[model samples]
Target: MRDFLPADKARRERVLAVIRERYRAHGFDEIETPVMEEHGRLHAGIGGDNEKLAYNILKRGLDAEAIRAAAEDPAQLTDLGLRYDLTVPLARFYATHRGVLPTVFRAIQIAPVWRAERPQKGRYRQFVQCDIDIIGDASDRAEAELVVATLDTLDALGLEGGIVRINDRRALDFMLDTFGFPVDERPGVLITIDKLDKIGPEGVVAELAERGAAPEAVEAFRAFLMRPQTLEFHPYGERQIRKALPEGAPDDIVAHLAGIGEAVAAARPSTGSGAT
Candidate 1:
């Protein structure tokens, strides 16, 4: 049997205790879901890439060769697989137990998920994900509160330089459409741009070009990425910015980003005690 030394067990238990205490203080109700889930729902709800990363299980009575073949090709797996992430499973849980939950539900889930990937330092095929998601309310305040809670959690964990980058897909879509990018190619563009920090400008431009974006469009995107002030706006400047969005675009996205900026600004203490 695998064994844990006394000191190791004590350290692990202490870590878990700290996590539970922080989550509880933030008013999150703890819940659990099964490790095995319906393969169809998990694959569909979690996302395509995530679906590929799921660990599938074969049932009894299946031939060993068939099971081995299925394992070789995840596409052939049927009906069930190990959980990939807590969010999709949580969504399933909420759908199943909606009637008993409050209109505004704040939940903390601490569970292990399986991923079919090579493991390395700080990366694991099976690891615990601690998450807090507030559902049923579309308020920007809720989103901002989540950001604040994340910052606080990092502080409590003694982590430094933990930057929480926030972006609204809606704002991104507005930018893409305004620049004349085809709707179908927007996801590709965003995915490329999202890697800018890691791969640098030239890498992002090459990826965008490879994905069939026009040279002009790629240049425009590069320009936008270089401009930090795009997100830096006072209330009046923000009002003017919203007015600049393409006609028929959702105003709610602009309002939400503006509210988030406002909330962050308001919460910024001049003393620099907790600016992060």
Candidate 2:
């Protein structure tokens, strides 16, 4: 982590203030959660690859023999961990306080989160995250509101022309199925694909091969990935989404995202100026 001098710190706080005000204006309530959570909750499979980067806190009062006995299972030694992201803590918070909280909770969390990632430019072990979550809402309206609020916040900060890309796991699953990937292998396949930005297409194909994904499916996906790529900015809509995915894409998912785009544009007239 880097130290912020007086000027830098003041500037950062000013930006955070603007974010908080804009989010609050959108009807989101700010909530605070402990920076640490039970090690088990942090490791529960929902965290995806981030679980590995969690900074676990070792249990106290462990004797030499106890430590030796638990050596094979290191997780047994840690009772708690620094939260790698706010999502897990938010889940626990909602579960514990659901009875007292509103049926539909709109939360704004701006706090520091810790991870054990290797230090690199533009990335750090500790950093602040600004997150807005809509809990208990299953409709596409929640997505629309989130997009509108974020765009509004950016505009408030004098950073216009922000672009938001809408994607869904269902779309990924649909594409994977179209390539004949086995249902059971999709989870592992996703972990590999998450590294695509770091490993490039060839590396992804090689790793999938090493992981024993179906050869035909792997070849099909590799071919799809190797195709000539182009960047064309299209307004968020059903047509743009269809062009991005294969033919026969699920109509429901497409409509869901399209509806979100329409709702966002209706809420913020300026969103039509290439904000998607």
- Clash pairs detected, candidate 1: none
Supply the global lDDT for candidate 2: 0.88
lDDT of 1 by residue, 1-276 (tens): 124699988987777677777767877789999999887787673354566788877554777788787776655656688998888889899999999999999898898898987655665788778988999877878876776666666656677644556667777777887666787777567767777786898898888899888778777766765654444223323565465454555767766676775675566433122221
Q: Which parts of model 2 are misplaced by more than 4 Å?
A: 197-203, 228-231, 271-276
Which runs of model 1 end up more than 4 angstroms from their true locations? Answer: 1-9, 45-48, 64-74, 119-121, 160-162, 191-201, 212-216, 226-254, 264-276
User: Could you tell me how far off, in angstroms, the CA of residue 163 lies in candidate 2 after the best superposition?
Assistant: 0.9
Count clashes in each candidate, considering only residues at least 3 apart in sequence or on different chains. Answer: 0, 0
The window of 10 residues in a row where model 1 has the poorest summed lDDT is 267-276
- Candidate 1 to truth, TM: 0.75
TM-score for candidate 2, please give it.
0.92
